[model samples]
Target: MTGKERLIELLKLLYAVTDEDHQLSTAEIVTHFAGQGVPTDRSTVKADIDVLNNCGIEILATKGTQIRYYFSDRQFELAELKLLVDAVESSKFITAKKSDVLVKKLMTLAGENSAKELERHLYTAGRIKPENESIFYAVDIIHRAINSERQIAFVYFEYATTKSFVPKHDGEPYIFSPYAMLYNEDKYYVLGYSEQHEKIVTFRVDRMKAPDILDKCIVPRPENFDPVNYTVNIFSMYDGEPYNVTLLCKNELMNYVIDRFGDDVRTEITDEEHFTATVEVSVSQTFFAWVFQFAGGIQITGPAIVKEQFRKMLEEAHN
Candidate 1:
């Protein structure tokens, strides 16, 4: 074999068989290289390692009665890679087949041993995943439009009685100036300015298809627009104007409040047993349903108009 071939084989050996928790001694490396038809002595193996280190491979070595070497740094640590793998496996935006492919790629960032650990911990049973394969393409095109400052056009779809998606608005082409992408409720959405309505709106990216970047430039994002506040108010991606709502809640449900509204909610002790919190939320039927399901544990106590609206919604539902 050529000199370059032997050196390449040695480098592959170090990367494949060594990790932070697992190290290969000089003797073991020589044995493995020999088995691979690249026979080398201890001195030659040491020289090869030095050459690799000089070339910036970042191989770490330990010396004592026994000498061992390991690849200390990787693109991502084992723990970080494992976390990414878990996200891919658990995400609902990615399809089942795509999740497997993504998790497999994430595992390769670490060594073979670390990959086995990630594989063993993977649990992807009975989890719902999106059926739209073109969603990825839609995301790519949206990103390109955002970068190029151009408009995009696509046909939106909705679920039908036959358990399949049917195009909305009689298969009309919707045009938008995409401002940003958001992940909420484990789904992806694109916040954009709708040209047809001449207002800021959001569309489910996974439900969008045949996205094409138009020649016209995009409309600038509103100067007063706040993406963080927008995401916070868009509960369950329901469309409604935002309201600074106050809710009187039982103190025991503090965890529930934090889980839903996060830690930024303004809270005041109403009594020893209850508290009041003022939160900005998108007032919609979905938000109303969420509050109704909580029963008397939570009650809207302020904004006389909102209170009346909630009452009317309940009364209509009853009749």
Candidate 2:
């Protein structure tokens, strides 16, 4: 092999063979080069390593009598890789097949010896993954439309009794201008302007089909629209009319309140045991269910109609 090609291959070999637990001396590196069919001497290998270090490959070396060398300062440390792998495995939007594919790809970022360290973190079993496999591709198409500041068209789907994806609204595609893709509750959702709805809406990416970027320009976003505030309105991804509701919350459950409503929730101390919070939320069955989990620790204290609706929901559940 040529000199430059041998230098490049040496880096690859270092990645394949050297990490903290497994390191190589200059003599050992020369042996590795010979094994790869690129004959080189110990002096040349040492010079190549110096060149690599000058270029900032982060291949570190020990200063002991043996003076072993190893690749360090990777793009992703093992902990970060473990976190990413856990996210992929637990994500409900990514299909099991794609999750496996993504995990495998993430592992490649780690070195040869360190890659095996990540193997024990692979646990994709028993999680409820989406059946749709085209979500990743769908995201790509949506991102293209968003990047070009144009519109996109896609068929939306719903599950039937037989667990098959049947297109919503007679298989007609929805034309939309995607504003942002959101990752919430381990699922992916697209927030955008819907042509048919005449307003911004959110749709699950997995529930979409035939995502294609359109040639037309997107409708300019409304000046007053804030996606961050709008996201709070879609509690649990269920859309409803936004309302500023008051809640009577227990003192100890304040963390849960902030956790759900963000840190900016308006609050007034009600008494020694409870506090009153005025927060805007999209009222839906899902929102009511969330409040129901807190038992009497939380209660709707205002807008008699909303309180009545909660009462009706409780009654309906009771019956």
Candidate 3:
């Protein structure tokens, strides 16, 4: 067989063995490959193993068995596997039947034991409601636009409406260069550069419809454009000016804040019960809305204007 075909067969055998068990002896692997119509020898198998390991397949040799190889920790983590299943279940792009089929295929690759555990976790903790099919279609088009560096036009709605094609009150087409998709609260938001506004903007994926790709390519991303910091600073999916905001969070909320903000957070313990944290982010309606959700546990400590606004909102809500 051709060298490429031989390589494919060797890799397939490796995958099959790894899927069944985390470890396999070199003798086992060689025998397995030989059964698949490939001649296997110690030197040849050793070379193939080296090639696979260099290609990022984690194959570890155990102490007792010079021949045994096992997947490294990087191959799969229980948490990451669970998250993958969760993402698939929550995706709107694929139909239920299609998702089931895909999950089954993934399970085959992961092997039965891992597959069962993944299924258990998914069924217990994972819950997702299906979104409109059109949203999925639009998102697919937007992804293509982003990858191809093209502009896109789409109809977007701010609120729900039953009437179809109401020309005047319906939506207008908007053109933009797609930047990225942000997932928050189990919904997808698209960040893009708006041609009309000459600025960056975010649109809810569900509201977008009938996307058309344009010939124009995206301008180069700014030298300072950082996806992680940009998303965090915006506080929401929408792009805007950023501000450094300080918050007084009770110890109860310390873990929550750290989990949300990660190492980017600057924190100091004020007392046994309270901690002060600072986050550099945009002051947006969404930011305030999030603060409101953590009302009793978190208090805005700086940016007096935002603090006052938040106080007024609380007062108004109580009134």
Candidate 2 lDDT tens digits, 36-59: 887788678788889999998878
Better of 1 and 3 by lDDT: 1
> Global lDDT of each model?
0.84, 0.84, 0.71
Against the true structure, candidate 3 has what lDDT? 0.71
For model 3, residues 1-319, the per-residue Cα lDDT tens digits are 7666776776665555454256677787778767877777788777877887888776667757366765543455657767777767666555566567667766655644466766733442445545345666777888888889888887776633875534222466887788888776667777877776777777777767688999988756777777667666673424444777898898988777877677668999899999999987677666777677886788888989878877887798789
lDDT over C-alpha atoms for residue 91 of model 1? 83
**Candidate 2 vs candidate 3, TM-score winner:** 2
> At residue 148, what lDDT does model 1 achieve?
93
Best candidate (score: TM-score): 1
Q: What are the per-model C-alpha RMSD values against the true structure?
A: 2.1, 2.3, 5.8
lDDT of 1 by residue, 1-319 (tens): 6767777887887788788678999999888878878768889888888888899888998887889999875889878887888888788778878888888887777888778878844666766877767887788889999889999999999999999989997899999999888888777898889988888889988888899999999898889988777887663427886788999999999888888888888999999999999988888888788788788899999788889989999999999
Task: Sort the candidates on lDDT, descending order.
Answer: 1, 2, 3
Pairs that clash in candidate 1: none
lDDT over C-alpha atoms for residue 279 of model 2: 85
Please report how far candidate 3 places residue 259 from its true position, in Å: 2.9
> Candidate 1 local accuracy as lDDT?
0.84
User: What is the lDDT, from 0 to 100, of the residue 64 in candidate 1?
Assistant: 78
Better of 1 and 2 by TM-score: 1
Off by over 4 Å in 1: 121-126, 235-237
